[model samples]
Target: MRAALGLYLELHAHPELSGAETGTAERFAGHLEGDGATVTRGIGGHGVVGVLRNGPGPTLLVRAELDALPITERTGLAYASTVPGTMHACGHDLHLASAAGAFALLAAEPDTWNGTLLVVGQPAEETLEGADAMLADGLYERFGTPDTVLAQHTAPLPAGTLAHGRGPMMAASAALDVVIHGRGGHAGTPQLTVDPVVTAAATVMRLQTVVSRETAPSDQVVLTVGSLRAGSRGNVVPDEAELSITVRAATDQALERAVEAATRIVRAECAASGCPEDPDVTLVSRSPALLPDPAATAAVRAAHEREFGRHRVLDWPGSMATEDFPRFAVGGVRTAYWMVGTTSPRQWRAAHSAARPVPPNHSAEFAPDVRTALPAGIAAMATAVRQLFKETW
Candidate 1:
């Protein structure tokens, strides 16, 4: 536990961005090596795979992310992010530490369970590219396919609790990159310039109607204009405006409709502005909704009931958060994903009494209470794996 906490502090202090996790990969791989795992590096971009085989039985794979968000840290903790513009605000550092601790516990008690344990440190999860990259790089072909794949994420609930979804767990999402073109000219000559900056701002405002007016209220959809960049100086109008959008929906049909509406809005806004050319809308990445296997989920849920009392185990209604984990479910592979509580009891009480929400993932103020969450995550994971080995299916 002490070693795991130390590693957690180190990772939190120095977090790497997606697709640029070389040093992070080295540290994770080195820890796996210390635990006697046969380590493999660079499966995808900076992905690390550790293998521990003890007499052949069922193979179980545990996944933990290795990348951090681009947000700067605002948590005044002593081990807050050292980087000026990067922080592990999403609790991936905690995820990695818990995974490492679980492996260590299992490795020390080899006689208690028998099988192959594959601890995966997957990179680039934030950009929704790591899982696909690993699959394209022959992840399953090189490493033996496991009978069950397990992963857990952190949430703002009280620590020492776990949540499992009965059916759907996460949303299907897509990323769209748009570039709006216009005629650039001096700010004084407003009549001569098309002013893409104005068009971009107008389009952003108009896009809100896609959800509030266009889509059904019952059908969940989230469209966020995450990035928008235009002119360099206030005195000049830029030639082009770029916007990056992310759309997430409960179903594939809803997702398609939302994307189409967004595209239509952008093109119409450009046409109305009389820009030089049609706007460019490119699909960056798309991932289907994450629906965990029913039987596998049940097995893990039961394991959680045993590890942490039934009162601590709750049913997750579902979330709109997007993940690329469904990409690994190709070819009929059984996978289970759950949520672990990261908030301390005091934090929960304060939020409830104040009628305010706790800081969420990707927030600069978000930080997991390691003293309580770390041990629970480790036990929940190790016990889940041990239970899966004992299940019939």
Candidate 2:
């Protein structure tokens, strides 16, 4: 736990963005090597896979993220992010640290459990690309296929708590990059120019209907225009406007419908504005909803209940947050994903008392109660792995 805390602090301070986790990977691989695991680097863009074979048994893979978000830190911690515009707001640092700590525990007591341990530090999880990249690069072919893959994510709930979902664990997501082209003319000549910025603005408004009007009220769907880039100055109208839209839903069908409706809205808005060219709508990335295997999840949930008690462990009412971790479930590998709470007791009470929202994952103020959360997370992961080991594959 102490070692994990140190690594957590170091990782939290020097976070790297998605696809640029070179130094982060080096540090993580180094730590894994220190724990006497055969660490392999450069699997799929800074992805680290450390193989620890402990006799012959069912192979278990524990995965954690290596990259952080692009948000700047505002958590006001002593070990706050040193890199500007990069922060571990998503508790990935905690996840990585817990994986490292759990692997270390397993290594120290090798006699307690059988089989191999595959610890993966995946990169580009923030952009939902790392898992696919690793799989495409032969994650399973290179490393032997595992009987089970286990992972946990941090949530805004009070620290020392674990949440498990019986069915759907997370939402499916699709991100699209759109470009609207318009005829550029003098800004003063409103008659000659077809302004793309106007089209983009209109498209943004119409996109809201994809959820409010089109999607079922019972369904959870979120459509966000995260980025909109247009002209540089007010004087000159740019030839094209760009938009980055991310659509997330509880089901794949809803996600597809929302994305289709969004793209249609963009094209209609561009056409309505009499734009000179057809709009370009490109799929940036997409991830299916995370549905953990029932048997696998049951084993891990029981392990966590034994480790953290029934009160601290609760049923997760599924969330809309999406993850690429599901990609690792390819090739008949059963997977289980759960949530570990991160908010401190004081933070929880204060937020509840004040009736204000606590800073969530991806927020600049998103800081986990690492001292409490990290240890619990490490125990949860280790216990889950150990319990899975005793089960028949």
- TM-score against truth, every candidate: 0.96, 0.98
lDDT of 2 by residue, 1-393 (tens): 888888999999999999999988988888899999999999889999999998889999999999998898998999999999999989999999999999999999999999989999999998999999998889889999999999999999889899999878999999999999998878899688899988899999999999999999999999999999998888888899999999999998989999889988998998899998899999999999999999989988988888888999988999888999888887788998899999998888888999998889999999899888999899999999999999843
Flag clash pairs in model 1. Answer: none
**lDDT of all predictions:** 0.91, 0.92
Candidate 1 ranges with C-alpha deviation above 4 Å: none
Q: In model 2, where is the ten-residue run with the lowest total lDDT?
A: 384-393
Q: In candidate 2, how many clashes are counted?
A: 0
User: Positional deviation of 191 in candidate 1, in angstroms?
Assistant: 2.6
Off by over 4 Å in 2: none
Residue 227 of candidate 1: its Cα lDDT? 98
For model 1 the local lDDT of residue 284 reads 98
